[model samples]
Target chain A: MLDLHNLRLAENGVPHLDSITASFAPGTLTTILGRTGAGKTSLLRAIAGLAIPDAGEIRLDGADWRRLPPWKRPIAMVTQQFINYPHLPVLDNVAFPLVRRGEKWPAARDAARAMLDKVGLAAMVDRRPSQLSGGQQQRVAIARALVKKAPVLLLDEPFVNLDYKLREGLREELVEMLRTETGTTVLYASTEPREALQLGDRIMLMAEGRLLDAGDPRAIFERPATLEAAQVVNAPPINIVPLEIDTVARMGPFGTQELGALGRDLAPGRYRLGLRAGDIAPGGPHRARVILTEVSGSETVTHLDLAGLPLVMHEKSVVAHAPGSEIGISARLDRGFVFAANGALISQGASHG
Target chain B: MYRQKYLFLLPGLIALTAIILFPLIFTIRVSFSGWDVYNPGLSWAGVKNYVRLFEDTRYWSALSRLSLLAISTVLIQYVLGFALALMVWKDVHARRFFRVLFLVPMMTTPVIMSVIWRTIFHESLGPLNPLLDAIVLGGQPWLSSPGWAFAAVMIVEIWQWTPFMFLLLLAGLLSLPSEPYLAAKIDGAGPVRTFFSVTFPGLAAISVGALLIRLIEASKILDTVYVLTSGGPGEATETASYYIYIRGLRDFQIGYSAALSITYLVIMIVALTIIAKLMVRFLVKGQS
Candidate 1:
């Protein structure tokens, strides 16, 4: 178990993280999702003991890590920039930590070779780091980290540079490897929602140095605590619209009427309604003009201008929607979310239509 | 396209031939002749000068001392420079100060530095002798003694050139990618293992280049030794160039001096060739 309590980090006198408290279970992949400069890397570095926090307690299996030096910590971090020693042969680089601990050269070499073989880089063991390609270098770095045999694995954007196929493949393999082989506590950070959703068992949503929410991946994505969380966890963004509640009118099924007394403030007043891109259906109640359409090979995303608001929807098959074409759009209310203008989620039985 | 480029190079080619090739041919011809200021004409001496060069004890001794001076200077400069570079590489605080301090010796004029060192090594009034006298050590004759004079010359050579090595190696160290060190650190490598397995090998090219430059510079050492010792005491610090100067200017043995100069050039060329071969081998092995 890894726990970070009241962790606060500041850079150049500016606060980057404010009292973040979280725990990551053993043998689980916990991904932190955030936009650029959201303190994701900073948080990871702080946890790994690379960057010191202003005020915090980092404990691994109940031992305080803040009191220990980085080398003494049982955490291994892989930064975005692959740090492979260019002078040493690939095998030696992987085996470096063991050799440092007074392991003989032959024993270190054998261990390094085994780790390199696991990463599918056995043949390049004798070559220098510079001789390998970018992907290969990243793999070597991973192998080196594994050779350290640290309990906590912190990866900061490890597969950001890789192509989609390689990224997916590595993600699957890495998750499985971490799960079966080491039972290492993995903290992976990425800005990509699909990657976070795919890799993370639990997702921590961050925005502007604040933890908005943390929960299981499915719950976090399906029911974000805040609009910011929703925006960060879904690609192409969740479509949001401001609407005034008419209490006298009939409420739709699974609509704002279910929100009882809380609908009083929203009565005949402005409220933000959110519908995920995936929740906006093709053949449903409303009709709108097809403002634009972008076709991706696997899925097609379309932008619809409805009620003077733009709503984005994703479809599994390609949709031929030309600009200015009128199209019917529908949404399953249960699958959607509604929030007050102040950005608070409208709880069921407390909001009006 | 080739014709136009060749036409542009024609004048440079002709000048190179006249300035470099022609003089080289003349020097080779003169090296074979028995010409002097008295004769003012050339006569074929053939292998006599070469044989004479081998037979001359003074010339052989000078050559041997030159070799020692070159080796010692190269070794000392490389070790001192590499040590300084490593310190500068690792230390964050006082790095700029140390860098500038190391370079001060290199920046000083060789003649001025030699005069300064000579004053410091003065047997009676020099600071070094007084310090040695106070430290329970006997003050030995520096420039006045044969052995001390040779050692003094070597010291001066090392002090002047070590900074050059430091600068080159420091640049190499700075240019190296930081990834390997980080990787080594991640692998739990201690400082010593990391240095030997990673840092030293990484700085190999720059080290070799610095050593080669020092070797060449050491072989041609003239100004400092000339100022400090003047081939002094009893020919103890006399180098090939110093001997050539003595024979050509002082003794008026111009033919023999020219012969000695030719021999010196050949020896230097052979030494440079061997160093170059070693450098190439190192590069090839590194690549493979």
Candidate 2:
């Protein structure tokens, strides 16, 4: 296990990581998901011993890793932008790390060939990095990172430059490789939450350099520790609207509607409700007008004008509602979350966390 | 249609004849004949001037000394320039300020620099000798002795040209991709191995550019030699260009000087070509 105890990093007096403390289990994939400048890259660099935290300690397998140099550590990194030695053939680029570790040149070359074949890049052995496509070059970098047989691997947005269609394929390949290569801990980081959802054994959410929440992908999706964490992992973003809970709850444009059965028992106060498009549905007694509707593949998404405020609902394949048409909106309040005015989580799925 | 296409080239062709071809033809013709500024008549001397050029002892010695100056100055300039560039390539406190300071020497006009250095190298009146004497090593004649005069000229050349190499090398070092460096750091490669494998290969093309410019310019060196020593104390610092100037202007042997100049030109072109070819041989395979 790799433990980062209270990692705090600041740049030019501006704080980047505000006491990030998390432990990544061995042989498991821990992916940190965050938008740009959220300190995902810095965390990965700290793990690889490239960026030293101002106040923290890194221990690997119960040993203090702060004293070991980056090269002396048992890890290899694949940068976000794929980089290879332009002056060496693909074969040599892969063989380089092994040679640096005191292996004989011929033996290193043989091992590198085997590693490249594993990544399905054996035919590109004689080609230089410049001669290959972006995806292919990343394959070479991956091969080089793997040939060292290090127990730890750090991948920082390894497929961001590839085609969008190709990115999912490469991500799956990498996740599969990490799975098959047991006993190797992989710290993968990306801004795309769907990538984390698909590949992370443990999903780490970060915002403004703080670790917001970390748990199994499904569990975090269901009970994110904060409203902000829920917004980060949603595809079309979660709908967060303010609620004025008076004697009767005031929700959306639907004038002073009674609180739904799930929220009826809550104290009358101000709060924010966060829910995905799937949380609300059609064919219910709560009345609203359709603002706009979209049918994609097997699902239909209808934006509803609930009173004067907007709410969106996802329906099955055949449902259709024209614009400005009145329709009943139902709330699946069991799947929604409530937060305080300061954005702290007050409840999960209609109950206190 | 073909005539119209060829007609478009007529103006440039006429200008080339007047500027380059005319002077080149006159020089080639004059090199084969006996002619002087004092004589109005041109006598066909065939290979007589060429034979005399081969037998001239001063011509051979001057070429040897120029070769020595070119080799030593270029070596020192590249070595020192590379060291300085590497020093400032990383996170220095005032990185741009140091780069601009290093470029000050290259920014100055070479002729003016040579005149300034001449004063500093003056045997008796210069501050350099007094400073050396104060350091417990007594002063010696710098420009008055033959060997010291050559050394003084070489010093001025190396000082001015080292900055030229520095700027080119620094630009090259900065242009290197950051990914390979990060990869190397994680690959367990030390600083020395990273330099040899990652840094030097990336710098090979720029190194060739720096070397060629310095080598070709140093071969025709005259400004520093004129200001510092002027080929004094028994002809120790005379290069081929300086010798040709004396032969044509002072001795009035324009034919022999022109012949010798053409021969030296051919030798220089051949030497530079060989060096460039060798530097680029295996590098072209992956130097990208």
Q: List the residue pairs that clash in candidate 2.
A: A253-A307, A253-A308, A253-A309, A254-A306, A254-A307
- List per-prediction Cα lDDT, in the order shown: 0.80, 0.84
Cα displacement (angstroms), candidate 2, residue A156, comes to: 1.5
Q: Which ten contiguous residues of candidate 2 chain B have the minimum total lDDT?
A: B279-288
lDDT of 1 at A1: 92
TM-score of 2: 0.88
lDDT of candidate 2 at residue B248, scale 0 to 100: 84
Candidate 2 residues lying further than 4 Å off, grouped into runs, are A67-69, A243-250, A254-261, A264-268, A281-331, A339-353, B37-41, B282-288
Model 1 interface CAPRI class: acceptable
- How badly does each model clash, as a count of residue pairs? 12, 5
* DockQ versus reference, model 2: 0.52
Per-residue accuracy of model 2 over B1-288 as CA lDDT, tens digit each: 477987889999999999999987777778887888766346787998899989999998999999899989998999999999998999999988999999898889888998888889887888888999999988878888888888888889889999999999999999998878888889997788888888888888888888988999999998777777777767989998899888887888888888988888888999989988987775544442
Cα miss at B209, model 2 (Å)? 1.5
- Candidate 1 Cα misplacement greater than 4 A, ranges: A246-270, A281-297, A300-312, A317-334, A348-353, B1-9, B86-101, B125-140, B190-192, B276-288
